[model samples]
Target: MSLEKQLNLLKQIDNCFLALNGKKLPSPLGVLDRYLWLHEKAPYSILAQGGEEDPYFIYANNYALSCFKYSLDEILSLPAKLSAAEENRPKRKLLFDKVAREGIVYNYNGDRVDKYQNTFRINDTIVWQLEENDGEVWGQGALFWSKEKERPRLVYRI
Candidate 1:
């Protein structure tokens, strides 16, 4: 994606979070600097999915890519539902429904599985609609922290 597009979407995520929680997301690099820090150096995992029936990941920061054990291209091609274990998809759907109605959901905790089938629990996640200023919903964005503190490590590159 173009840098402009990336920045716009990141801004939406930041704006939606601020609107819901009355505070910007924690970022030592500063809020407007999210486009750079979030993608390259932020500690938190960030991702966004877009589409209607079966949304696919449209964006996944390096941290998120590492957490899911997938390269950017791989993650962007998978359906968002696949992020969770098969059994957890129903619960994930319910949470998506809630976000559709509420615009944003905070403190979401869930079990997620990576491409390698390793399971991990994500706590205190923030999920929000990637809505445009005019009210068009493009997709959903999320922020989470992985247990690992190191830089993104890709298992495979394609």
Candidate 2:
């Protein structure tokens, strides 16, 4: 499809979740709204959020869902570590720690596991800290698959 057509479609989809005035809704609902928008615009994108103790997925687009062969509910319920291969778990945790301390970490390459427990290489995954009004840190991540011969690119931005 043409870019214009795709964008129009995305806009229509976005309208269903976001208010007409463009204000976002509450926590998980707002997350879901954006998820639907991104899913329509870029299905391959993965959206994740982490806590002090666990990295849980708060949202993922349909393309991301299909890539992992998971339904939305299944993916959201999973810990972020579940996406990392067993051997990569330690490194992933270390990277998460780095993001927590520094506010953001970029260009990190690693393998991520899908629902079927398949692993895919993520070339330039970014992890960032999400802060509340009080400045407490929460974890956020954007994951994307790299193209052949090119560096891995971030599929979505937080």
lDDT per residue for candidate 1 within 40-137, as digits (tens), equals 77777888899477999988878888889998779978999999999999999998999999988887888999998899988778888877778888
> Which digits, one per residue and each the tens of the lDDT, describe model 2 over residues 25-69?
112323444534555444235455556477677656566677677
Candidate 2: deviation at residue 101, Å? 1.2
Off by over 4 Å in 1: 2-8, 29-33, 148-158
List of clashing residue pairs for candidate 2: 43-63, 83-113
Choose the strongest candidate by lDDT: 1
Model 1: how far residue 23 lies from native, Å: 3.1
Task: Return the lDDT, model 1, position 90.
Answer: 98
The window of 10 residues in a row where model 1 has the poorest summed lDDT is: 149-158
Q: Candidate 1: give the clashing pairs.
A: none
* Model 1: lDDT of residue 32: 54
Clashes of each: 0, 2
Per-candidate TM vs. native?
Answer: 0.82, 0.65
Candidate 2 matches the true fold with a TM-score of: 0.65
